[model samples]
Target: MPNRRGLPQKWCHQELEVNEMAFSHRGNMTECKWKDKRDVYFLTTKHTASWTEVTVKAKGGPTKEIKPDRTLDYNLSKIGVNSNDQCICIILLIEEKPMKWWKKMFFHLMAHAMVNT
Candidate 1:
């Protein structure tokens, strides 16, 4: 069932027997949906519309499953970014204090620059 945006309303992970995928694009933005153990949505500007195979172990043994390449790429690329965010939150010890919008943005940017360098 498609919603107003022509995307599926929901997906049931428990009842899913195979991977279900859907995608939509506008200009530079691409949105992808893949249903495995649960529904995962990916939004990106760098990835093109494509599919790729990944190996997964099932009751019958390992099987090659097709999934959106963007999903895979997003998952792989996010590890470093997530780690950076964690480090900025933990190691930098930056807390959200009441401040002006520009000051907060400046501090956040400085924190990220420090962590990256």
Candidate 2:
């Protein structure tokens, strides 16, 4: 799409993808290949394909594993559910004093409103 100046917009940016081969010296683009039975590919322009060590706990204790920065950041960013579900959970955590179901529901809604405010 063009702006008011009649210049076309930049439609492409070097971003990340899953399961990519080792590449270096590329412009803001990188890929991470995860070891799995299936062929996995990762690509990202915001990070490099270099491996960094992170701690992981197994049956035995804490151990270090090397993974790409893009992979780690992507993994960390995933918050499975939407904010609505999270809000519901947060608002329902208070223990009620033997109240009716409807009263409990009202309090829950009130809590949700307070949090939103």
Candidate 3:
């Protein structure tokens, strides 16, 4: 379902489960094992409105999903962009200052090293 701004109106839900187990082997060595599983669902709405709300539930374990409520407003003038052959130029102005004695000496040494190499 497309909204007024031509954007899709859909809600996505996901569930994840993690399991950890530890085991001991020979030579007093121990290792930890991990397991993970996930489930996802997508819900789409065709109605158009300024705001919408959705509720979700989890099958097993405690539910940790939180959905935010919000609204969006669009205007035509804010979406304008230039794509034509028109050229845009930018100019930067700067003031020059005399370098310190140590800085001048460093640049001279670098220039001499480059020329020798």
For model 1, residues 1-117, the per-residue Cα lDDT tens digits are 223463334432324445877677767888776677776767678887789889988999999998888767768989999989997777445555688888877777888888899
Model 3 over residues 8-105: C-alpha lDDT tens digits? 22212222245322222323332212222422222224212123233436577455432211111222333332311111111101112477888766
Q: What is the C-alpha RMSD of each candidate to the true structure, in Å?
A: 6.5, 9.8, 23.6
Cα lDDT of candidate 1 equals 0.72
Q: Which regions of candidate 2 fall more than 4 Å away from where they truly are?
A: 1-28, 36-40, 79-87, 90-117
TM-score of each: 0.49, 0.45, 0.18
* Model 1 lDDT at residue 56: 80
Candidate achieving higher TM-score, 1 or 3: 1
- The candidate that wins on TM-score is 1
Kindly report which residue stretches of model 3 are placed more than 4 angstroms away from their true locations once superposed: 1-97
Q: What is the total number of backbone clashes in candidate 1? A: 0
Best by lDDT: 1
Would you give me the overall lDDT of model 3? 0.30
**Residue 14 deviation, candidate 1, in Å?**
16
